[model samples]
Target: MTAMALTQRPASVLSRLLHRHEACRGWLLLAPALCLMLVAILFPLGSTLVMSTWSLDGYSVDRTPTLGNYSAMLGQPMFGALIGRSLVVATIATVVTVALCYPMAYFVAFHVHRHKALWLILLTLPFWTSYLLRVFAWKVVLGYEGVLNTALIGLGIVQEPLAALLYSQTAVTLVLAHSWAAFAILPIYVSLEKIDRSYIEAAADLGDGLTRRFWRITFPLSLPGVVAAFFMMFVPTVGDYITPAMVGGPDGMMVGNLIQAMFGPMNNWPAGAALSVVMMLTIGLAGLAFLAVGRLVGR
Candidate 1:
């Protein structure tokens, strides 16, 4: 009995410690997710970081690590240009999507008295289709002699199809905006919906107008959602190669297109990895800047 009691004492103490320490219990609960992240995300990032330091020797990889790829990027103007273009396009798309969707989200949140779920479903219905299909659909609509051009010519709005309508920076921006509209709408709606009506009522009782109430109470309260929408929209758009490939011609080729080329036809794995790392770092910095701006605005 004394031997058995001694054997159980350590196990009991450990059990009690685990039970008493909320942080330990919390970590235990989170262990599965953390392990999955380690496998899926961190491992790949680590590999990429290592790969970025390696170089290619004609038809073979030099296992010796060097910063030649990073140095090459610094010397090349094209790399900087493409990255800048991607940043600009993504920023424009995020701004446009959020600006356009805000009113729709506000209407749905404030004006719709019933069938709110149905409205949300309807709003998101377009996203249920394949993203590729949506991009192609936009391509068709914006293409020369396509729907919009056909209508414009038929109605005497223009005698010729607008070549500039498709395969341009504007086209890329427009497609990105349309693609991410739902993402923007949902967050803004959730934020607006969660706003307390009593505050608005209180403001009204104090003789404030609708615009003033909205700017002061509603908009401020919904900034979190707006910030979320912007972040969500911006991050994905910046790395999008597909939309640019489909709608953006040579004039609108972004960093993602270049990155894809590097990994594909260029067959420069180290350079591609280095560019990817740079893009990831750029995104992290941009995201941090966005969060800082959001905090400042919130204050």
Candidate 2:
């Protein structure tokens, strides 16, 4: 009996070892991706934080760590205004894109059967072009002597070019909205496509009107897409520098512009790094808040 029990212990120990070996293999399979993320993302982020504590000029570095940069940024009245402008532009662009894309997505999803793929292709066609070129085209169109102003003048709508039309907050919002439209449309279309057709039919059969059916059946399910679209538009717009630089007036400059200045001509690398970190944190927090709100509203 003692000999038999000793032999059984070896078998049990081997079984446990095999189980742990399988688990280790699974972890090994995931190791490459985890390593890549750490190298590509985490390393840069940690380095940036370290850099943010030290000031650097063009040719030399100041090893002294100070909160003076942050203090100066907070002291500036323009800092608050720039942050406000960025938020306003991002929010407006997100709202407009989501509202406009929903109907277009709905049409492509439910209304149009023939050439649906063609229509979707066309919708995404603009993105194939260079973003900077597209922005330049908008700049030309909104310029004082541009097509829009010329057309309006020809129609006698106005005697002169509206200087306010270009290089204004409105121009920034419009261009960003146009640029981000595809971001808004695709997700909503995907969501609407995934919804079962029978559900809509059943709601109709129950005598729910078109508006009522849409509100009850369609809208709730599409919340995920709406949330996705909002983030897609909001995140990039908040950090956008090019659009504001080209089209935005001095008054319309965003926080990204300031960060760029700190890194570039301003020669304040530490401040720029700090600002970048803060912006990332702000965006992360905002995204989490939006997700929470979306879940609550969905319920």
Candidate 3:
């Protein structure tokens, strides 16, 4: 093309793009992301919903859409109990993880200022390894013939191995808390670190005691991070079956194990899909309700 024509074409393209409505421009920019989300998230979710309605008939999956799966899943008291148990364990993990994480984050943010980078590296070093490996490490440490039992036995603290340490609800909670500690700590640390020192100093200057300042200013500001940490720890722990399966014994198993069993040799795909969809919807609604309550309380 001629030089003048080429320049004119470029200017025309730029001018047209620049002159577009802001909302239209924004949508155009977001189109690629919307397409990706449609394929990756919505498509699979749609498939799952469709499959949830399919009933098994002898050999083939009956394509007829029916609420049979939902009826079957909801009718069982066992499923309700398992779901409640999962929530309880997840709640315990969230609370314990946050409780332990906040103090550590506070210490790191306030006390270890000099080697902060080194401390952060050491803090996250455990995550470089496989998540299961860490859970397994805990299993070894808590086993009947493992470190805790052997140490207690050597120290004459207990007469026999502490069988209670390895395969119970306690073990599940302990392992989950430990496993997700880093997720809790990092968000809290970031929030604590971001608290402008000036606020604390100003509070102190105004005769506010440390306790008063913390309750009035620090805790409120850090709550976003705390909530983030709680959800991060809570959501996955609800669906976690690996830690329970490896260390839980029969009593410690979560709802995820039952879902897996349904999908596996049980050949109950419709029921499994229904259970998963219902659980997801329940969790989502609960999260939304929580956010609504938090917003109302804040006002």
Candidate 4:
């Protein structure tokens, strides 16, 4: 070959090699996260599906795959009631938390200026303690001889300790709200923080009142974070067993409590697995519905 042609061929090969190297690097960077997710999430989900098809007692796994467990779950009258109760509790808790947090988030984002960081730290400070301990603390406070009852009696607000204070749906809802309040606040605060000050100022200059400016510009823009927080709080609350078990009475027992009982006291792993699978499907559908609503509202 001619020397010039040979040199040009070498340069072309080197350029192609460098391009492939960059592409390989990008794939290598993504591989670890993909692998982690497959192992952590997808693998467990697949295993749950497989386990749901068989009977697993504490003694041994029955290799005979059957739909009997699912059928039993569906046929049980309590299953529908349990699911309905769970949805109601989670929905109410999510709504209450959002309502309470939005104003607080708005205050912290727009009203607080000098010590905003300190206030945020204070807001999140309660979560630094163990969650179980916090729940236990609430139990003490709401119990018959606890702080709230004592205060009410001492203040003459009530003649006697309110027997309905603990072990009721109301108690469960209150605790859920307390447990998940920070989850709601941070997201709404982030959304409010991202709003451009100029937009509000311009709206005011256009003779828009506070209500008009907020409705027209602020609320619409902050919606993504609100939607995100709603799901973040709702999904976990739906599956939460602790708060309900701790405070929720017989009437307040959620679907998660039943699932736990199937796994633990009942020794019915297959049933529990089926319940988990069903719950996952339910949550996935709910998420899609939420996203659709969010998009509709945003548009």
Instruction: Judging by TM-score against the true structure, name the best candidate.
Output: 1
Model 3 poorest ten-residue lDDT run: 290-299
Clashes of each: 0, 0, 0, 0
Q: Cα RMSD to native, each candidate?
A: 3.5, 5.9, 2.5, 4.6
Whichever of 2 and 3 has more lDDT, that candidate is 2
Write the residue-wise lDDT of candidate 3 on 1-299 in tens digits.
Answer: 69888767655665577577677688888999999999999998999999999999875689999999988876789888988888889888888989988998989987886989888887788788898999899989999899999999999999999999999999999999888889999999999999988998899999999899988788878888887887788888989989888889989988999889989978888888888898898677766776676566555
For 1-299, candidate 4 gives per-residue lDDT tens digits of 69888777656665667677997667767999989999999999998898899986568889688987789878888887888788888889999999999999999999999999999988888798888998899999999888999999999999999878889988888899889889999999999999999999999999999999999999998998899889989999988999989988777789999999988998888889998988888888878988898889888
Write down the lDDT that model 1 would get: 0.94
Residue 117, model 3, lDDT? 88
Error of 4 at 190 (Å): 1.0
- Give candidate 2 regions above 4 Å deviation: 1-33, 56-59, 64-66
- Which candidate tops lDDT? 1
lDDT of 1 by residue, 1-299 (tens): 99998777766766788879999889988999999999999999999999999999997889798999999999999988888999999999999899999999999999999999999999998899999999999989999979999999999999989999999999999999998889999999999999999999999999999999998899999999999999889999999999999999989889998889989999988899999999999999998999999888888
Against the unseen true structure, what C-alpha lDDT does each candidate score?
0.94, 0.88, 0.87, 0.89
What 10-residue stretch in candidate 4 is worst by lDDT? 9-18
Q: TM-score of every model?
A: 0.92, 0.87, 0.90, 0.89
Model 1 residue 127 CA deviation in Å? 0.8
Give every collision pair in model 3: none
Return the candidate ranking by TM-score, descending: 1, 3, 4, 2
What does the lDDT come to for candidate 2? 0.88
